[model samples]
Target: TGGSNAFAAPEAFQTRSSSRPSPPPRPDLSSLASSAAPEQHAVSSVPEQKAATEAGVLPLYKIALCCLLTDLKINCRDSLLVSRAQAPSLPGYLDLVEALQQRVAAAAELKDVAALCSVFSGFLRNSLLPSSCSPDVQVRLLHALAEVGLDQRRE
Candidate 1:
């Protein structure tokens, strides 16, 4: 029986064939070299072409500034109060206001109130103000705290 089994295994091995045919040789790439040159040229000129095409478009900063100004004008129209004082009492009030406005505009553009709140929180945390502060400062802080609370509640 063992002899017969060994003879059958040899026959099986002799009759075995590959399941798939061998692949053909790689084609010559020399013919495609000339076509590749034009593709590379087209790719290289893409940015210059894009710049030429976009020349008529408004700059991004200008567009953002326009949108921010329009939004502020519409939303903050009622909040704009004419003070009797000739100059601001605080030295950096104008700068602070401008910074806050820019931050608000950026936040509005990105539709991210949490980022704005985090930024304000960091500012307040790092500020030189003490716990016992003026009423105006206390009111502003309270407003910020309320806004953060509301944002948390919404989430």
Candidate 2:
């Protein structure tokens, strides 16, 4: 026992929470960590309303909804983001989310298959293709959509 020196500190230095498990690690987002918020793009009210109306119509709404759902299929392959796991019977509790999901589900009609494809292509090009993927890939998608009369570039 005298071979090694025993200079260790007393048990009073130990912490009480040392046995507790550590919290989950946070996600690392490059270049988005600063306290300064991202710049907000100003959207014109008139055009926004028009776009909303166009997307709200029976045909267009169906197309938009279907496209959105198809694109989100990858992310939601595990679970639905809009659907609640545990729900309550409260008035208008999740009406907006439910309505949106319903609209997307109702858009799967055979008559508007072309429109649905166009919407899907457009969404993939503008919203889904960029940022998450390389710029070169996004450009290729934009070109493809352009050939099909589906402009992927934002106005």
Candidate 3:
């Protein structure tokens, strides 16, 4: 070998100066876009889905479960699966709750007992909206109320 320091690195890296590294060359975006399948470009074009894909919070059910458990005076913080980073804002949740309320109200107005019953059943069965209130009695009471509502005149 020539009289050179074995410890010194060879020009394995391209550098602007002996001590300074230059930035890596930018990739040819046009070539990349052209080379990629058409579907890949389509997915990236939709900003909402692209953003959601890049960053995401936990599922809605987890948030609902936590809130439901909290309302029932159950401590679940120790077992929470979502971090603060993943938690959605309370303001954002208001719209979601309102939408759900409106849906339930519509079902009631339409006398869709099955839809209403499904919601009732979900309250008891699904972890999303569990309640401490007497579900069986409440359900029977709700059933009777709906029946009575059927006989009432529209205002």
Top candidate by lDDT? 2
Say which prediction, candidate 2 or candidate 3, comes out ahead on TM-score.
Answer: 3
lDDT of each: 0.38, 0.40, 0.37
State residue 146's C-alpha deviation in candidate 3, in Å. Answer: 27
Q: Tell me how far the alpha carbon of residue 92 in candidate 3 is from the true structure, in angstroms, after superposition.
A: 0.9
**Which should have the higher TM-score, number 1 or number 2?**
1
Point out where model 3 deviates above 4 Å: 1-83, 108-123, 126-155
Residue-level error in angstroms, candidate 2, position 21: 27
Q: If scored against the real structure, what TM-score would every candidate get? A: 0.23, 0.22, 0.23
lDDT of 1 by residue, 1-155 (tens): 01121111223333442334679988886665675556574554776766655543324333443343343334332232232132233323334334544544554323344333342332333332212333443334334434444554477
Give lDDT: candidate 1, residue 19: 35
Q: Rank the candidates by TM-score, best first.
A: 1, 3, 2
Report the poorest 10 consecutive residues by lDDT, candidate 1.
1-10
Ranking by lDDT: 2, 1, 3
Clashing pairs in 3: none
RMSD of each: 27.9, 24.6, 23.9
